[model samples]
Target: MTEPKIAIALYSYEPQEEGELLLLEGDILTVLEEDASGWWSGESNGKTGLFPGSYVEYVDEQLIESLGLEQFEEISEESNNTTEQDLTQQQGGEFSGQNINDENYVSDEENEKDNTSQNQNQQEIIQTQNFTRNIGGTTMIHDGFIWEEKEPVFKVTIGKTVKRKKLRGMKKYTAYLIHSGNFCVTRRYKHFLWLRQRLVERYENVPVPPMPEKQFQGRFGEDFISRRREGLNRFLNRICEHPILRSSQIFHHFLEADEYQDWKMGKRAAEKQNKKEVPFFKSITCAQEVTKDCDDEITEFKKNITSLDKCLKNVENVATDLYLSNYQDLSASYLKFSKAFLKLGSEAKGIVGKNLDIEGKELKERGKEQRKIFIDPLKDYNRLIQVFIETIKVRDQANFQYVSTHAKYTKQNMGELSGQNRDKLLLKQDKSDRMTNITLAEIELFHYNRLRDSKEILTNHLKTQIEYYRKSSERWKKVKEEVEKIPVIHGSKKLEGMEDLSEPELFDEKIETDTEENQTSNQIDKEIEKNDEDNEEEDDEDTDDEDTDEDDDDDQTEETEEIEKEKDENEKNEKEKDEKENNDDFEKI
Candidate 1:
C-alpha cells in the first residue's frame, strides 16, 4: 500500500455536487487516493472528500517542512485579510466550471514533470475544437511548452461585424462577433481597448499583446475591419497560449462569459482588483529553483532571444510586404486577368472561346484559396512574432523589478533587517524568484514555438507555390486538349444569335417605300396641271372684257372732239378780225 501524500491547495474550489471536497486556496490536505481522472480523495480539516487534483498541487513533504511556519503564517495572514464569504462572493463562481484560475487564485507555473498525470487528464477535458486545427503541435520539443495538444487550447475568431446602437440609438458603434468554442460574445473595439488597459494594469510585468492601433477615418471599412479583427485574433491567441494569462479570471470572463450582465460584473471585479495595488508576483507560481547562476544563463538567453527577435522582425516585415505585394495583389490581378479572358471567351462564341471561358473561370477561383493557404499563414506568423518581441520586453521589465527589489533589500543594515522586515524581504525574494521562473519559462516556450511555427509556415509557403504552378499547368493542358478537338469547317457559318439578320426583307421594305412615294407624287402633279389650265382660261376672259370697255370709251371721246373743233374754228375767225384792230390800238396806247 502507498503512503498518504500531503498536498497544498492552489485554488478555492466550491463543490458542485455530492462526494466533492470544498477547497480553500492555500489549504493543506492529506491525499488518500489518486485517479487517472482528475479527481483525488483527500482529507482536510477533519473532513474527508474527493477533490480535483488540479485544485491542489502535491508538494514534497520535505519541501513543506523546509518552508516551515513562515509560509503557513503568510497563508494565515492572507486568510485573515480576506474573509471566506468575501472570497466566495468575489472569486468563487468564476472558476469557468472545472477550469483553473492560476493567475488570480492558483499556481499554474508548477513543473510539468510533477503533475504529468494530472496534466494529461486536464488537457483531455479542456480543449478548443476550433476549425484551425492545422496549427501543428505534434512532434514538438517538450521543453516547457504551454500547450501539449496539436491545436491551440482555445480559438478566438472575430468576424461578423454588427453595427449596434446604444442608449436609445443615440450612440452607435461596431461590434465584432468573438466566437470561441460554444460560447460567443460581442465586443466593441473600445471594449478591447478597455480590456488591454486593464490587463496591463493588472499584469504590468507580464506581456499583454497590444491591439491594432485605432483609427477614426474609415473605421468601418471592410479592409480596416479585416485587419483589426486579425490583430485581435492574434492578441487572443497569445493570451490563450500563455501559461499564466490563460488562467486569469479576466481572460475567462472575456472569453466564456456570454451574458452582458455577467461581463459587466466580471469587468467591475477585475477593475476593482486592479485598484488594490496587490503585487502581481505574489500570485505567480515559481516551480523551478532559481539559482544564483540563473542571471548569467538568463542573460545569455536574452542575448539569443533579442538577436532572434531582430532577425525574425526583419523576416516578418519582408514576408508581410511579400504577402501584400506578391500574394494578395497578385491574386487579385490573376482573378481580374481571368475575368477579362472569360468575358472575351463569352463574347467570341466558338470552340476556342469556350475553352478560354473555362480556363478563365478556373483561374479566377485560384484567388480565394490562394489567400487562404498563403496570405493567412504569413499574417498569422507575423503577428505571432510581434507578440514574441513584446513578451521579451516585458520579461526584461520583470527581471529589472527583481534586481531592484534585491538591491534595496540587501542595502538595509542588519540591525534594521530583522523580524517582520526580514520576513517581508524574504517574501520579496520569493516573488522575484517566481517572476524569473515565469518569464524564463515563457521565453523558452516561445522559442520552442518559433521553431515549429517557422517550419509550418515555410512548409505551407512551399506547398502553395508548388500547387499553384501545378494547377496552372493542368489548366493549360486542358485548354490544349480542348483546342485539339476543334473540327475543320469548309465554309463560313452564321454566328450564334445572328441567324435573324434578314437582308432580303430589308430590300423589299425599301422597294415598297419608294413605290408608294412615286404614286403619291404623280397624283399631286396631275392636280397641279388641271388647276393651272383653269386659272389661264379665267385670265383670258377678264382681258377681253377690259378691251371692249376701252373701245367704247374711245368712240365717245372721238365724237366730242369733232364738235369742239368746229366751235373753235368759228370763234377763231371772229377773234382774228378783233385781234387785228385791238393789236393796232394797243400799239398806239
Candidate 2:
C-alpha cells in the first residue's frame, strides 16, 4: 500500500531513541504504519523507523493541488484562448490527475509528470521561504528588497490630548497617524518608543534612526507635542527608506494598529517568536569571527563617552552652582542698594530712585528665572550623557562576554572535539556572535541618539538664554535712562548768591586768554620746526627724483605765501575791530 507523507511543522524537544526516526522541524517523511500507541513508523532521508505521530503534522496534498490550480488559472486568465488543460500542461504537468477527491486517478505517465512537478514546486518553496516571507503586507523580494505597490508614508499630526483610565486622568500626548489616508492609528510617544526598542532588538543589521528625547517639563506643552509629532513622522519616513527595516513586523504594527492593546499583544507574540533558537547550520554566517578591531573601536567610543560625560557634568555644575549663585548674589546686592536708596527719603529720592527700585526688583526676578532656565537644560543634558555612558558600559560587557565565548568555542571546535561537540561549540559561537552584533548596533544607536539629543538641547538652551538676556537688557536700558535724567543736588550753593561779573574781572579773563594764545603760538613754532626736519628726511630719501621734489617744494612755498597773506589780513581786521570796541567803551565812560 502507498503510504501517506507528513512534515514536522514545529520543533520537537524530545530525545531520540534507538531504531527511531529523529525528525527535525520541517523534515518530510513517508508514513509506513500507524500503531494504537500513537506511534507511526516512517521513512525519512532513506531511513525507516518509528516516531511519535504527535511529533509530526501531515502535509496537505489538497493545498498543493489548490496552489497548482491557482497558477494554472492565472495562466489561463492571461491568455483568453488558452484552455484549462492547455494551461495545466504548460504548468509542468502539475494538475495532470483528476480532482483530489476523485476515486480514479491519472495514468502512470501523468503521475510521473505530477511527481516531478511536485518535487520542483517543493524545492522552490523551500528555497524562497526564508527570504520571501510576507511581513505586515510588505512583500520581501529577492536580495532582501521589499516590494510594495505604494510606499507607505506617515502623515503625523498632534491630536487633542487624550485621557485614559490607565494614565490616571493625566493628559497624554496623542499623535494621529493618517497613514497615506487609507487607515489611521493613534499612538503616544511611549508607543513609538516601544516600537523603536523592538525594531532595534529584532533587526540587528538594520540601522534604526533615533527618536526624540522625552521632555519632562513640557510633556503636554503645545510646541513640545508638535515637535515630537513631527520628529516621529520623520523617523517613520527613515524606516520606510530602508528596505529590510520597512518590512519589519513592528514597524508595520506601529503604522497599522487600530487598538493599542492589540498592538501590544502582537508585539509580545513577535518578540516571543524572535527569541526562538534558529539552527546553527541555518546561520552559517554567525561562525565568522567579529574582528578584534571592532572591539578596539568600541573601547575608543566608550572612552569618548566617558570624557564627554565628565565635561557635561562640569558644565551642569557650573550652570547650577557657580553661575547661578553669582546671579543670585548680584540680585541680592541690587535689592540692598534699592533699600538704601529708599532710606534716603525725600532728601535724595526722586522718580529715578523709584525706577531704580523697580529695576532692582525686576533684576532679582530675572536672575532667579535665568538660574532656573540654565540649570534645567543642563540637567536634561547631564541625564542624556549619563544614559550614553551607561549604554556604552553595558555594550562593553556584552562585547567582552561574546568575544570570550567565541574564542572558547573556536578553540574547542578546532581541537579534538567529536562531531556533536563541535556542533555544540559552533552553536555557542553563533549565539555569541549574534549577541556581539546586537550590542554593537546598540552602541551605535546610543551614540547617534546622544549626538542628536544633546545638539537639540544645547541649541534650544542657548536660544532661550539669548532671548532672556535680550529682553532683560531692553528693560534695564529704559531704567538706566530714567536714572540718568535725575538732576544732581548741590549741598551748600544757593541761587540768590550768584551775580553778573564786573568789567575788571571780564578784562582779567581777556588778558589770561591773550597769554594762553601766546603760549599756543610758541608750541605751534616748535611743531613747524619738527615738520621741517621731517621734510628734510623725505628730501634725502627722494634724492633721485629731484625734478618731482623741486615741483613739490615750489607748491609748498606758494601755499606758505598764501597762508601768510591770509594770516596778516586776519590780524589787521582783528586790530581794527578791537580799536573800535575800545573807542565805544571810552565814549560810554
Model 2: per-residue Cα lDDT over 1-589, one tens digit each: 4366544322222234678765544455678887665567888668788876655555556554766644533322222111112222221111223122122223468765755565555545434333322233222222111122235533443445453444665644455544534667777677778887877566543446667677778566655665555556656765665544665666777777788788778877767655442321122122223455445666787787678768877887776665545554554455444434433334333333445445545554555454444555555445545644554554455445534554565465554433333333333333444444444544555565566656876676688678866876786687677667756777846543122333334212112224433343333334334433433533444564886889999999999999999999999999999999999999999
Candidate 1: clashing pairs of residues:
none
- Worst 10-residue lDDT window for candidate 2 reads 83-92
Q: How does model 1 fare in lDDT?
A: 0.56
**Which 10 residues in a row give candidate 1 its minimum summed lDDT?**
129-138
List candidate 2 stretches off by more than 4 Å: 1-127, 130-289, 322-418, 441-453, 486-589
User: Candidate 2 clashing pairs?
Assistant: none
Model 1: residues with Cα > 4 Å off, grouped in runs: 1-152, 166-172, 326-428, 459-463, 487-589
Against the true structure, candidate 2 has what lDDT? 0.51
Residues 86-129 of candidate 1: C-alpha lDDT, one tens digit per residue:
22122111121221112223335464354455444333322311
